[model samples]
Target: MQALGPWLPDDPALPPVALAVSGGGDSLCLAWLARHWRKNLLAFVVDHGLRAESAQEARLTVQRLADMGVPARLLTLTTLTKGPGVAERARQARYAVLAQACREAGCLDLLLGHQADDQAETLQMRHQAGSGPEGLAGMAWMSALPDVRVVRPLLDVSRQALRNTLRGAGLAWVDDPSNQDMQAGRVRVRHSLREQDEREALWRAGLQAGAARMRRDDSRTMSFARQGTFRPEGWVCLGPVLPEPEDLSVLIRCVGGQIYPPAPAAVRRLQAAGQEATLAGVQLVRWRSGWVLVREAAAMDAYGPAYAGARWDGRFELFLPSSVSRESLQVGPAGFGLDRTVRGGWPARFCATLPALWRHGQRVGIPHLGWWAEEALQGAGFLFQPPVPATGGGVYGWPEARGAWFAAHHI
Candidate 1:
């Protein structure tokens, strides 16, 4: 519990902390530990429905949590189907639903139960896939997602230790058969780590790599503060010289509104090209003194129904006053038919990618450029909130640095 100080804030008025309980021994133990740590907590059991017994397992997990005096909810993923890459698909779907649940529950932090064994397996898998240094770091204690932070308090603890904790408390857990499936890469890695020495070596390797990665991130953050200007218009202005490849990737990811950055090799190639190029739905164009990274206009999503809090293009969030009717309003790119005089010196390419408000095919608002059709539309606005920050958050005790960066940039 002392180690969780950096991850959780001590505030009573905040929403309850959340846990992702899979009914497995690792997660059940986590729930038990969390129950003792704080009473204001919520647990979520995700049912992928990949197997017939998944729903029942979820229900059982919820009941077990109730017995532990922990409030829980079951999230069912209905869109997932068994096919090629089913494991990856199920994992992605699970996290998506979990994040949505956290948002609806007003949770700022979502605890996961990935123990040391899982981290070792991840390290081995990434090593086999030729992952870079960042990937070799395995998992961070805390990862800041767009909507919430995913935390792993037991990353350094072994799976057997967690199971033992549950057993000591006279608790039982559901054992998923898929864990022993040899066809799965993670399962294979888990089995290979039967030797304590091998597991400890892998865990140590991850720790060393994570320490190095944190040092790199610190330098990267300083570099961003020195040479990059993040505009509230969802674009980034860089100095005359292109940033380091990693920093460049961060800019592209933020401007493109992507959850992950473009490949490091692709970023290196972009930097080598040096003049002007486009990658990962972002275009790097030469502006006045430095270069401007902007979203590709053609890659922008089409108009979708606009409500008071609709998020458009994954980059901008719409806000409308209660007085405005959402019947005919739509949110999409600020394309043609807009008055040119209201552009306010923003480039046409940049303007075209901005999230705009439309009603029945007529342009009504371009919040970034401060243009609205009428006085009634004045209250409508859009905030540039990308899926990932230019300086990604994963290190522990780094929120203060992130908050300071945002404050200095007026983001």
Candidate 2:
């Protein structure tokens, strides 16, 4: 674990840390180290309920951690409706449960044990899938989850070393039956990588290349952010020299207010779509001397107003005073034909796409537009945030401007 010193954040004021432990060799080693590193470590186990042994294994795992003096909790997930992508679905559910638990416990850091072998296996899998550099780069040492930061400290360490450590410490770990299922792509890839030593070099080179690429992109993205015009109306205008696909992905997520960027193929098409196109629910058009990104009017989300704090269109977070009742207000787009005189200089088309508060068949107000009708609501606040944090920096770079877009529009 001493090898982790260079990668750990220097801030000593970090909140209690959370680790996702599965009672497996990798995670168990992480749990042990985390217990010794931080007095306030919270261990979370997600029981996917996919197999008969899952429940008992979860209990035994937590019991062992508790015996080791680690605070632990088991989060049992309801069985998912049988799906084609059971593995992927289970993975998503697992992360969601862990992230929620971290939030509840006021932990910002979520640790995982993904060793060097896992990194090499990932690179192999992505390469076989015809992935780009971003995908082939494998996992980052640190990645931002919805609410928690995922720290993978074992990326440079070998899985065999971790297992040896556990065995030497007399720690027993549950061997998941699913890992041996050859039907899974990861299992197949893992077996192939085990026979090839060349992949280790590829893994190291891929990570280095990916990181160097990120550094170059970070500079480009920062310059774009400084020079571009990101309007409160959910539009961003940038120069004609388009950014790389990775940076374009970030821009699409931010401008479209989407939790995930569109697929790589879709991003490439959007980039080559000349002066106008729509992808990932975002419309891109040539405006003046540069490209502009805006939320596609027909694709935006709409929700009925809630009592106090309400999110509308997945773009605006609304906080109405207690005097306001949600039943009386309709929350949706202003749509075409909205009068713009009171909206100041906001573009008519853009203003029409804003989240409008409607009452008694009239538009009362919109976020960033100021309250128009006194009876509609007084002392109301609005915030513009996408479903996920916009990693304003490009691929593999620090999130230097992670929340800048939200901050600018949070009123």
Model 1 residue 143 CA deviation (Å) reads 2.1
The local distance difference test score of each candidate is 0.83, 0.71
Tell me, by lDDT, which candidate is best: 1
Please write out the lDDT profile of model 1 over residues 256-350, one tens digit for every residue.
98876788788989998898888999999998888999999889899999887677888787788988878888998888555568777767777
**Cα lDDT, model 2, residue 227:** 68
TM-score of each prediction: 0.89, 0.79
User: Candidate 2 clashing pairs?
Assistant: none
Clash counts for all predictions: 0, 0
Off by over 4 Å in 1: 6-14, 336-339, 396-411
Q: Report the lDDT of model 2 for residue 241.
A: 67
